[model samples]
Target: MRTLRASVLARFSARASSTLAFDSTSHLDSLQHTRIQDLRSALFKGGAPSRIWAHYTNILNYFNYDVLPLELHQQVLRQCSPPVRSVRLSDAKRLAQGKRLEHRHLHEGRFQAIISNIRALGCTPSLDDYHFILEHFAAVGYHVGCHQVYQEIIHLGLTPQTKTFGLCLQAIAHRLTLPTFEVFRMRLVSQTRKALDDLMSDMRRFNVPFTTANLDLALRIFKETVDEEGLNKLVKWTYGIDLDNPDCSPLDLLENQTTSSPQPFSTHALNTIIDTLGRFGDISKVVQAFEVLSQPLPQAKQYRFSSFDDEDDFGVPVHVPSPSNHSLPYALPNTTTYSMLLRHISRARHSTLARHYLIQAFKLDRQ
Candidate 1:
């Protein structure tokens, strides 16, 4: 998902989008293509803003304003804008102390300038273009900007894609979880719930299965809001299960439901479930999940060229028509898994249980 990729990349300094939008760039010649790419790279690779802006003029002249695809306009606007790095409270405070424009305002100005840049390029902003900026706003911790851009998209009657909701939801979750936001907790809590619910509902209209990244973001939104009802609502939405199924627990919904999304199994998802259970003082469920993780991964014989033990697709020896003894290999728990469990056990302050997990982790790690 575009939303997922953007969120992950936000941790690092912002760079140009390597991916292009769903449009026609095929008409452009190789020279034109390479020039656009060079401009994109130069945007963040270190250069003066004035020179970058000038390069934009050269591109326009080079194309002679012929066949300016929406993607080119979008990338130009997207790249020419400033980098969206993490904004700390300290940074905000530092900006407030200055008489110049605020830090966030500087961010706002660049975005507005890019919109003007789009018009200068004789291109109307497409839905994908707006989504790019919305994602950008979300990345820089400006939930309000994300909401405003989203509203404009709706007002323009542009039907949003799934990534649209993902960006807004992720923005809300990221902003609300900040320590600085705690003071306004009571006022924002109810509003956040309604807005989040609305976003989810809007996303469902597309009738597409949520990507695992989006689902993970939803999990975070529910957790931060502490909405048990919403948690069950997510379970109902993803899987056909609800509170009516008393035997079913949220942990069961931890799996990636749609094959179109993340991997079938994620140790991260498992760890989150384990951590949630521990938070609820549900020690039994935590232990159950841990035991499942602790189970020995199935082993199989490794290939040995000297013995001619390698097998073909049908599991027959390549050199001979004999059945291969090797079995399918599986992934085992990694250091991260063991580290999460160890911390969880340590928090409960159960020395014997902690010792057991540590010893098991020690033995379980092949590395």
Candidate 2:
């Protein structure tokens, strides 16, 4: 019942936001100002959740849902369901006072109840509102709550935006990291698989394409769960290759490029992909990814350590081989790439492989 009411109101967040889309009179502004101020006070001044709740109810009663300004309502939403960053600060404060953070149901109930109340007042919640709730939950540690909110959005026949899918992927990935949830690891992986299926269906339904961010979230989950097959599918997806085709080469992305074209894999982006593969204990793939990036354009005066022990710490000549591939992304990995590879390779207990990377890193320090 609590979840139901929250879901109902969750929809209204969107509707209520745009209700007075173009204009709000002085009458509306004044009514919202006091309550918004009070809500902000409670959040920042270390007021108890009970006090925050009090200010919240006052806002509801003051506007009667009919004249609730979007700013005020979003403020209440922040209090009721903060993103992970806010939750961490609030929790830290609670810990200092030797109190647990507020109970889950209080927040869940309040969040949905806001949506329900908005709808009861005959304001339809907008899609933006639904995304707000889901995004908050995605960050707030209510990983599954993101799904619950998403389910209700669908139940109400609401069309979600691309960001919604990204949020849902984030939520799905988060649970796999929690120690308390480790015992349910397989179940969490399965949940991600289901979310992926739902995402594909929705993609077709709305004609919305999935973004790299979406693929990255799913990759995070697969990385945690050590789901090699799952990682393979997404890695293929990430490179714009067909899942069923065996003939595709990641190198194809480089080959199709025009000479001197824009480098597709910037160093930071390639490092992220390398890190993802690293997480999967696939150092070979990591090295392949690193190699695939066109070596950085050589500096006119290349620098290398005189030797490992030379404390000079200045640029010296270190000749780097030029790329044979005429068309490839001209990005090169940095020390971080070395660190990621070493971390994962060491994790697999292969000291020799780790040592090889350290040597490679020492050789590449000219960058």
Candidate 3:
């Protein structure tokens, strides 16, 4: 009886699939107009939303249905307004599986379909939606996909938050192609720099606030892509650290800006910027960045530091949390920071200075 039941269920599933296929084909062949109302009603009549979406995409391709277009996919979403939670979850799962399977193109095709569906529903995609799409493209080095999502956010009049902006910078960075020939390298680098400039201009237009994350990502992008001019521009903006101007110093910016509002710096951003400057053998700028990094973060939340003074655990060895855990404004130099400084000194052939930094690093660790 159990074997018979299983057989019957399998037959029923196959029959249902065949019946739906036949109906979809007939509808497509019979109608030149292919009204969206009918399309939506037909596609969603049987299966779950995700299944329906996947099936319909395959059906459209199978029939070579040009009349339907991408907009039809959107129309189904707008008319039905199927809960996107499951669809998005499924998308993430597929992407993860695709990565393991080495099928990036297939993953992107599905993602494009998902985006079309989101747009079709006449619903403004949230920051999370945009971020997910951007990440998919960014991970695969699909720079065009990243730009499309960025444009869609702007079209919806949504300002990308700092994290989103950082992702955008990273996506642009991935477009960079390093060439062995100097001529090709120059051309490629120039184009990338222009693209980056345009992205920054868009950020300004959208009123996206420049934060430590943004600055750090931008600096890393420039460093990786070998865009010295871009790096210089970033340094000047973040800390007024310009190599061409020997007189320029962090102290000058801090003291002069006391009369104005000084921009708050993050230790991570300072570390990355200093590390990059050090790579270029700019000892003075590296030192300046360290000075800034070591200073107390004036803009940090005061309540966080206030807890440090509380006497609730008097004589008890107080457990101090790292910057990430405690919400402190600045972080002390970790091992990586000292390593960068040592590398900088060594690269400049200053064995004496490198040894000095190495010893300092060890002492700090012991303390």
Candidate 4:
């Protein structure tokens, strides 16, 4: 039994020595030194994830390792330096206090750098991370940044949630749309209109919730393009109203509460409808739109109306239409509403109707 144990111990010692000799003689030390040098080169670059990743690849190649350890990968990512424009908490607070325009640019650059670094490190950003970037771009009205983030999210094999999808639509719309100018009008107005319609259709296809803001975006497109057919369909979906139905007036749609609760229309929405009608519809259509705006909303909801707090030198308060109180049981027509009505009346070449509305507008303003 002692001879057997001695034999086993000798075999173990011989195997260990052979392993050590192979490691010493087979360029293992040189390979290790190369890896250390690569790591140092990567780290000394001051936090560039791509450079670090490349260095890591070199180390793997030298060692004939297919992949780095996950722990080491993460360590390299954590050590990477953030971009210079990334605002610290205190710097952000200061920027917020000052309300500088550059804040948006700073945030945009930071998000870009973060996403690039994350990708360089082979890390997949989650939905929440992508949403944060998208929302920031949307808030800042930087449609280009929004699109860049959106494309990256798609490329990452991730599905966009409802809000992300909505933001993408908004970003695309903002990019395609240009401010209307009298001197140099945009030539792509028709193309933009088509794109907007397609986006709205996509929203419906995806079953995105029809929030007020989303509806407003759709409505704005309809108004801009004078797509009355589209507007009617939108109204039918949003408020369950069919304007063509013989029994229902536009005001009736707002008044009848027997069905599901109608989403309240903003004064801006009312104005948009009136404006659209003024541009394309006949005299009767404009009149119908005006009457709807003139109707007072339920007293409970009246406070939704925005007040013009400014007073004349005589202390006479301006009685403008409340912005939110488009429906009424006491809705007043705002200047915009009156202007739309008058413009249409004049366009129809109806002198008597124009005069009538003008006089009524003056009376309402005085009140």
Q: What 10-residue stretch in candidate 4 is worst by lDDT?
A: 322-331
Off by over 4 Å in 3: 1-54, 58-132, 148-164, 173-191, 236-264, 291-331
RMSD of each: 20.9, 17.4, 17.0, 14.6
* Quality of model 2 by C-alpha lDDT: 0.64
Best by lDDT: 2
lDDT of 1 by residue, 1-367 (tens): 9998889888443433322321235535766777777677776575665566667667767685444455555566656555555334444565567633221323466556556666567656687777767766665456777777888778767888878888887777776654454576876677678777877777666555677888788777766776667765764565333333423323334354433222344556555555554665556556765655434333322332344356776778666433233221112456776676677778878788889878887876745
State TM-scores per candidate. Answer: 0.52, 0.59, 0.53, 0.50
lDDT of 4 by residue, 38-131 (tens): 7776676665656765676566566633234444544454444243234234345654686433323344544454455455666776777777
**Model 3 residue 166 lDDT?**
73
Top TM-score hit: 2
2 or 3, greater by TM-score: 2
Report, for every candidate in turn, its global Cα lDDT versus the true structure: 0.61, 0.64, 0.60, 0.60
Better of 3 and 4 by lDDT: 4
Candidate 3 lDDT over 1-367, as tens digits, reads: 9999999999999999999999987887665344444456666564454555555665555454444555554444432323334433544575567533221223555556656655665556567766766665555445556667777787888777766767667666655521135666666566557767777766666656567666666777676566667777656555555545523344445345422222464556656766777766677667655655555444333345636444445655566643322111334777778877777878888888778778888898999
